[model samples]
Target: MLIPYGTYNDDIRADIRAFGELLDKQAEAEAWIKQFDEKAASAREKIKTAVKDGETVGIYELRSQEFYVLGDNWGRGGQVIYNALKLTPPPAVKEVVDANTPPKLISQEVLPQFAADHMFVTTYETKQEDKDKFFGNAVYKNLPAVKNNHIYEMTFEQMYYYDPLAIEGQLDLVVEQLLAHQAK
Candidate 1:
């Protein structure tokens, strides 16, 4: 869905390939891309100040409350947000991921002591009932994040993306919650 910049600013080519007019306004296209970079840089600096350095935030993300904990190696939207915030998952949760370097199957049981200050849940539209039941369970009700009421519910469409727009939107929520968590 995106072009790597490694091959002579390939996204420029990708845009021009998809929208032929950009070929005639290559400089303008580059400038537009630069705008995104500047905005992103500004957001990063803001997050840095708000979140504080060396804040190894405890984050838990899953499509369902079925106990899988995704990691930075997943390349999913949660991973992208985690990378942007420069946050790392706590060791208590890290040891639960599938035992592989840059693991692909990042599913494991959620410990009752699931060590995270915040939880972001994105699930299927039809599975809301199932989600209610799963989270209603005693095991999940006892999780640290859950007990703290740090659970944040979001939709699949709002997340599950990797583009700049999606990243910015996700950060708006995830970072705000991070800041809120810090305040508590």
Candidate 2:
């Protein structure tokens, strides 16, 4: 079973079921599916509890002066990633995500105005020098999130999948980082 990169929650479950069918393990597949569903639900509820108000979140793979939303591989973008985690970006972030397709290129200058509340930077195959250079730029430095130190790190190796297992880990990371940020 070949699954496309742009798949959402149920689509992935369907993929799992398909794979199970292919392997003639329907019962096992159903069990795994139930586990995944429960995991997602638990994460969603925990996230809602952690974040009372919605926040504008920017998940990026920064390259030069341009950065792609979601991830560089275009695996999960727009509402797909959020939907998997059951998290919602504020209107500021949602508008752009809804308007543009996955792996949307958001120039450094413009993105800050849209979603400067929280940012997740992907460092997969990205040079430390380039990241440091971007960090020094006035545009990056001036962002409210930057000043407030609301920046967090994610890896393409992990987040690119956006599968049930990946999202379980992703939700934990998000909650941990957000709670830590709130504490500060």
Candidate whose TM-score is highest:
2
What is the TM-score of each predicted model, taking all chains together?
Answer: 0.58, 0.74
In candidate 1, residue 113 scores what lDDT? 45
TM-score computed on alpha carbons, candidate 1: 0.58
Model 2, 152: alpha-carbon shift in Å? Answer: 1.3
Candidate 2, residues 1-184, lDDT tens digits: the string is 5756544333566767777888999998899878867776776666564445655566777765456665222443322345556455656556555654556676767766555467777755557787888778888888877887778766667666645566556656666776787677
What is the alpha-carbon lDDT for the whole of candidate 2?
0.62
Clashes of 2: 0
Q: What global local distance difference test value does model 1 have?
A: 0.52
Question: Per-residue lDDT of 38-148 in model 1, one digit per residue for the tens?
Answer: 655666776665444543344344444344455543323444345555555656545543232232223244454445655665554446676677667776777766676
Q: lDDT at 58 for candidate 2?
A: 68
Clashes of each: 0, 0
